[model samples]
Target: MSRPVMGACDACKRRKVKCDNANPCANCSISQISCEHRIAPRKRGRPPKGSLRQLSQEETCESIENATADMIDDSPVNSLFEQDAASDPQATSVLEALATPFSPGTLTTPPSVSTVLRETLGKGSLAAFAAVSRNQFVPNVAHIFQKLAAAVNHQLADEGETIATCAHKCVDIFMQYLFPNTPIAHEPTLRSAAALFDLVGDFLSPEDDETPSIERLRALTLITALCALVNSAMSQGLFSTSKSLTWLFYNASRATLRLYEEYDLEFPHSTSYHIRMWQSAALQNSTGRDRASWHIHGESILLAVRARLYDEDTISRLPQLEAQLLRVNFWLMYLADKTAAAFEARPSMIPNDYLAEKLTLREQGGQDSLQLDLSRPCNGHSLERRLLTGFHLKRRLWAAAADMICELRLFPTRNQVFLANTEVDRPDISGLVERYLNFVGHVDHLPEWLQSPQRALEGVEAHVAEYQAASFWAQRSNIMSVYHCMKLVILQKCIEMAVPEVVGLNQDPIFWAMQKLETSRDFIREVQMVPFVCFKVQGEPAVSVQPFSLTSSVAYSC
Candidate 1:
């Protein structure tokens, strides 16, 4: 008969010695390594036992034989347990769990100086500064910088887009958080990079020797974010007007350009920046014509953009143009509004009789102007009631330009693409054209207290084609998907009205409310995640909470 088998510790199994069945045998326990044990769940029922006295030798032998037979039957269970332990919860360790797996197409390595860098540059790396030797940690800083620099160089040498993107992101984050505010005791890059390494130190410990995919995605996202920010500043003039803010904008721009150069990426179009700089400069002082120059530049940009939209190779130009045009309309409206206000505040500031007559008309009836439906794209009426001052006309033209942009965006396709091809069929923009007519029909009826009639009328007229177009933009998903972009645009436009003295003092109620609209727009962005893109000048946020039901999506067409 076979003797009954029993479990043993790893050390006992290796030595072929009988184990006392401690969690770990004495040898392994003393070595201070992991202690593993195989334990089966307790059975439900009691085992059979002798009822009275001790058994005789012959009975004991028979019992032993039965026990040996039972052990043989359970041997397969032990083998199963061994298989499960290889990856089982009981077998897997905390250290192993902490190590995140490296992404594919990357190399992970054991923690070295890079580990120190991650800790140092990471978010909260200075916790144990008193315990660890400062000198030891300091040396690791240089080593980390060397590694990062080498990594960047290697990425540059390689043609992989992913690697290049990742390298740029690492560099950008380092620049944003580290170099900007931190006081540097050494060369900027060294301290900055070291600071960065400190943040990610936890991951470096017992490093799994694999390259991370998270880093790649992180880099791509950061680059995209930076681009979006720069675009916002350019389109909205957020950082352009103030001297302090301009530095922020300029640094962001420089950082982006450096990233682009690092990967041999082509520069973005040159026109957008020039226009933004021009708008910024105009804001330095109160000059309407100078502000209008921004509008002219915008028109030039729009025309240039038309020429470049067709070649499949020129896809980048589309967004650049769209953003610039959006900005142009915003600033043009800004200048017109300001010009009208100037005429109101100092009637003597009227440059000519044309402006003077319009200002008179605006002063008499413009303060009570009602908003036409901006949700459905349409143009407003012509300014028949105007007189001398250019203020009303300027304000109207600005509003009209804004409406035109909305129509331009909603047009089935760009006119420039059609111009590029001699044989290309020109589809009618009649839909938007019709909406513009509806907008005009209502212009004569809308109150002038809130806006200049001419401006209101022109804006309504620009939406004519939107009424006839398909309702693609009216969907919940589509509206929300681009809501962030819309909010961004609105905030940018409102910011354009930053003339310190003139805009506030304008007697025209519409111009007066423009200040309120500035604050209102910002507040609306903060609260209303679901934006209706209203064209009506003064609706409360509560009015916008309902589902947007305009047939034409060009409601804010201007």
Candidate 2:
């Protein structure tokens, strides 16, 4: 048989199958096609001694100059590898030495002791420490790069739409469903950030440079967190497969946030604070009352306090738009803090004393101490203004409810300690009853427009009525659920506090139990009024069911 040829035939190479290296290979012969070897075979084995001649001094110098020119070129691919190589001196030096040319007669220098040690020990050295100093000093730097790589890989592997498209959709979903209720982020700012993010081809692209700026990092953090939240919300009903994507975005947001914190530790800007606040909201929605959610909520509160977001005087000194955004942001935080504290049965991170002082100052100023100012008024009874007004009213209600929860928390301790004491020695049952009555009265006194969705849209423009109606219905449902839940908690606590000996003497446990049943019925009615789509799309049932469960447990215990 003839000796086999050096390389595969064209047909076998094109099909990527093994070749017999015959003139007409078995594959092509079987298929009745002509076989060609037009492509050159790769050179194999080392060249014989003296087969290659070293370049002259001038030739070596010219080659070295050409290599240096290529290295210094501002090309994108070159710069990317350069940036990565720059992180390690050993790698950079090796690359440089490989690129340099030498004359034939030039004497080669012996390797240094440090170089020998490095080669022997294989990367265990103080130099490695110095090389990774950037990662060591900056929090989450390594993790951020890892996430960037993963995001890039995911983008590359995705056969469908791009991240930019998904990001735009997430933003739209967030603005439509969540913005009116939460509105922690400024609308224009969020849109602008999304627009800018769309322009980024790759997060670690050479065009973006070696290091990202604080502003870029902040925008990335916000976008990722927003996507995570929207994905989490959508995963509830629209897309069953989105849970993994939701967590992917969530973890990316966390990594970006840690990197941003490392760079901007001293002054936590509104954007960073907004990222944290929204992250906490996402955590609450995705994970429920987890410790991570609680910790993130606390971090946001700390950022707000540090930024003096709670101080009206400080807020008033800013531009009108900024002041308005900050005002809404702070109030949103306030509402969330109270809700988390009440539902989680934990002490609120926000200082009640500061809130009390603010109320006192407002009373002294002759304003309605119970009502929080919703900042600058819009020109007309616009939908945004109405929604803001309603949200502030809801915030007031939650504040009251949280106060009751705190008082109820103290009751168990007091009841246990003063078991044999009179009712006077225990937490004043009358005070608790009074607060419950007041909370109920507050809900009853809400404006007709806020209480009813149809009333909210009575005079709205034709173009905006749909949005206004949706906002009103969502807000009303939220307020009513909170109201009914708070009522159940207070009444249940009242029943618990009513000692068997005092039940007949002071208040009737049967009456409180009956009231709880009534409130539960009202809650059910309100829940039924909401569209079934709302329960599925917004995960409303998951949120509302927890309170019902709590009420059930309390009733069984009683």
Candidate 3:
């Protein structure tokens, strides 16, 4: 057969079908198409803009790999990466080295789509995918994200049931460990959502029916799955905890927040808002070495204040039942901020002047109507109510301890020295110490049910005893830590005044100082046994104390 010419006619090219060797080609003639043989001269600077040839798969891959390499070398990503990576002996990340044009033993072949996908997903470059996916019906990467979970599971899974199973497992993991500390996303609601999700999964898979709800529900399920996956992996190995957990949770949380921005949709605030709080808590606890959730805490504070969290009058306008719930919620947020500040030696976001509704133990004289009365405590309301009351009481004692600790550092400045002998500061410190001690005595005298771990939940609706126990242990551990820390700070600050002469032993003062030191040591030992439980102060009396967010409305009947 005669050889075909290098280029085809315009008509044949546009049609994208083979042409006959004749002047009018068989394709054009059969379809009654017009064909022209005229050729236009191309300019040197830029080729004619009519129509560019589509690249072959090999060429496309090569182009992408080359362009990516160039961008890495010339773009800001490369600059930032180098700035951070330059500290290493090789001065390059594994990724950077792999991408280099002439790296020894590195693959120089054109990258495959699978390769691209893995690289995109594995590196911090998931963000670019996230940004693309943030716009609805966007071109390019949007569909990639939409189908990301399915595509991933598709490879690892044989059928739809596996995804449903994963979804359930993740929900359990979340509810068990993290959810108890902060039920940001309400558990019961998530339970219902999961049910709906299972239904959605059944409809779309095997049945082959698809719907918009499927998409949204899928995103939500993916979030929990990612969260649980991270936690599960982190629990398994501490060495890679920070790196892996951080990556997984970031994508999960990004997908979560992106749902709101891209779809203009979010789970109802009743649950979603709290879930966000849980995310923040996890991030704070994500890394072993890094325990501070400061940035997240700070963001939460600003948002809370904007929502008038500090305004009791605004909160009181809600239904009497909800008003009580809201009050405890805000109180917990306050304590969280304060605890963070105290630990970091930073100023608190909760301004000292702000008026938080006082939580009071009920007595025969109901003098304080505004304060929550322990007599008609929140225990009887719901399971969460029980937690609210317990946490509120505990946090009050913590705040009291905090006040005593603060008294010791009256003025923190270069020239400021705490003078124990000063008449004015002396009584302030003495009185605070007395108050904290009395408060501990009061806690000791309180009813057993209030202080004991609510494992049986005999009257409560919640069941996970382990989760409750963990939450209780967390609060109890922190309380003891605060107590010891306060005692240590107090005695250490005043040891100069407590015992002036070390040689004579000054009988009473020396003995008292030694006793306080011993108490501090004992508290330290207790904490070591429950290291994870008490690391971060679950200052939120509402959820931290009662992870489920609802407990019985405990009454403090006089």
What TM-score would every model get versus the actual structure? Answer: 0.19, 0.64, 0.52
Measured by TM-score, the strongest candidate is 2
Clash pairs for candidate 2: none
Task: Give the distance in Å from residue 79's predicted Cα in candidate 3 to where it truly belongs.
Answer: 13
Off by over 4 Å in 1: 1-246, 258-307, 310-558
Ranking by TM-score: 2, 3, 1
Clashes of each: 74, 0, 35
Local accuracy of candidate 2 as per-residue lDDT tens digits, 354-376: 77665211101112111112241
lDDT of model number 3: 0.42
Candidate achieving higher lDDT, 2 or 3: 2
lDDT by residue (tens digit), candidate 1, 1-558: 323234554433322233455655554565575444432333334446555765433233233333332333233322332343465442223113211111111122213334434544463535532323212211122222233333333333434423234334433332222111111111222223233333443423321212222222123223322322222223223112122222222222222222222112122232233323323322212121233333433343343334442123333334543333333333333333333332232111213343433221112221222212223233122211211122233234334333533453444345566678868776464554453444333324323412232333433433442321111111111222223233233223323432113112334556546656655564455334322322111111112331121101111111
Question: lDDT per residue, candidate 3, 207-283, as tens digits?
Answer: 11111232343446335534433343343332222233233333444344433431222112222334344445444
Q: Give me the overall lDDT of model 2.
A: 0.55
User: In candidate 3, where is summed lDDT lowest over 10 consecutive residues?
Assistant: 549-558
Order of models, best lDDT first: 2, 3, 1
